[model samples]
Target: MSYYDVDAILTDAQKVPCTFELTVPGLGHLEGNPGAEVKEGTKLELPLWLAQMLAITPAGTKPGMITLDLPDSLSQKVTNALRADPRTVELRSLAPHFFNLGTRMLDLFEEEELSDLLTESFKLRAKELADHAHNPRGALGEGAEFLQGLDENERRLFRATHEGAKAVRAWLVGMQKK
Candidate 1:
């Protein structure tokens, strides 16, 4: 992801659960207790940027300072829902930058199942999105609910698809007139 990407920045700002592995002095401000020590095993929701840094940064011979956990958006419940029916899952409700966040998380954690699930989900959703885009009544009619559930990337795809269809139709009409 590019550093200048607003979506990437927003994804990095999203909070994720983290557990402190070791007690650290004057770090309680993260939990709203300023000037206090952050005790071991203290769990708190931290921005992905900070959490990722802390989780990967080593201290002496030990591995990292904190343990990172999947955000609620990518939890097992959501996974189950996607696996059951990807088209039915409202990805925007889960996370506006769902796919982007998933990509970032995949970099830190090795989850083959999640990777496959996301890929399959995107494939299914994109096909459905394309179908809806090509339909003149899709936006305001039956496919409205599905369109509303699209995440950032999918929305862009839908827009592009819809515009392409419109352009093609306009071209055909001009040809017929000629």
Candidate 2:
């Protein structure tokens, strides 16, 4: 699904119970929560925002200390893919989601290597897209059909390149007219 579709759901997602027990009480109250006593050993169901914030720092920093759960490692298969050529990796099919997830929840996961690899891949792939847009063959060519199947995120990237190409192409035509 697109980010827009999931944004609302994730924004208002109910706080789920976590296994971590609080050593100290955090100031921010969860939604639907009252000023209940929050002492040590208190079990808390944290909202996504609060959980993300708490997870980012060391456990001892928060006066309302609590256990912070770390995310599991990415699958070995995914790790292998990150090591592969970014150009061959399909952005529309997989990379976009990985990049987005890793970016937003960077503190929660130890995927810095993977994120770096993906970022490089995006740069390479974007250059390829721009190059293709700058020099189109024809409507029936492979490039046109390849673009037809892009997901929204990929399409957005392609659209920017395409627009740049269109502007340049128009300028060339105007020069010829002049």
Candidate 3:
């Protein structure tokens, strides 16, 4: 057979443009054939080292994860691992996390993952705000408070957040009683 099917989660995100490390699970193989096409596969794995040039390990205690800082050679291996006909790959992304200063809480609610794309797009929006914040302050002072003052759109977003928070608190209260 030219290829075999397997189910394996990505040990880390493959963020190449920026500076995230590239890492993969130590051992991965198809269920039917363990050592059949390793040579063919290893050939692909070789390129990963190149793709993951400026890699770094995550600071938190998450297990079996790597951050892809630069390009990596092993990305092809990740691609190959998920290359079965009619393929299916389950992906989860641990992108940038923001901390809430008011509550002193960690934010884990914002995330998105697809077969090839995993990111927090809001992070970019948030980053843009952070990057140009001082500029706006200098230009219009109070007038530039977009997300901060949050007109109608921001209020709607806050309402959604409040609903989500209520659900989470309900879950927590239920857990505590049990």
Which regions in candidate 2 have their CA more than 4 angstroms from the true location?
Answer: 1-74, 138-153
Which of the numbered candidates is closest to the native, going by highest lDDT? 1
Residue 11, model 1: lDDT of 90
How would the candidate models be sorted by lDDT, starting from the highest? 1, 2, 3
- Candidate 3 local lDDT, 54-142, one digit each (tens): 23335674422223222232144433533441112221211111111101111211222222221232333334344333343532563
- Show pairs that collide, candidate 1: none
- Tens digit of lDDT per residue, candidate 1, span 25-52? 9998998999999999999999999999
Give all TM-scores, in the order shown.
Answer: 0.95, 0.54, 0.20
Counting only residues 3 or more apart in sequence or on different chains, how many pairs clash (N, Cα, C under 3 Å) in candidate 1? 0
Go through the candidates in order and give the clash count of each: 0, 3, 19
lDDT (tens digit, per residue) of candidate 2 on 118-176: 57756766676666676677423766654553434556777788797799889999999
| CA shift of 4, model 2, Å | 9.6
Listed per candidate, the RMSD to the true structure in angstroms reads 1.6, 7.3, 18.2
lDDT head-to-head 1 vs 2, winner: 1
Model 3: lowest-lDDT 10 consecutive positions: 97-106
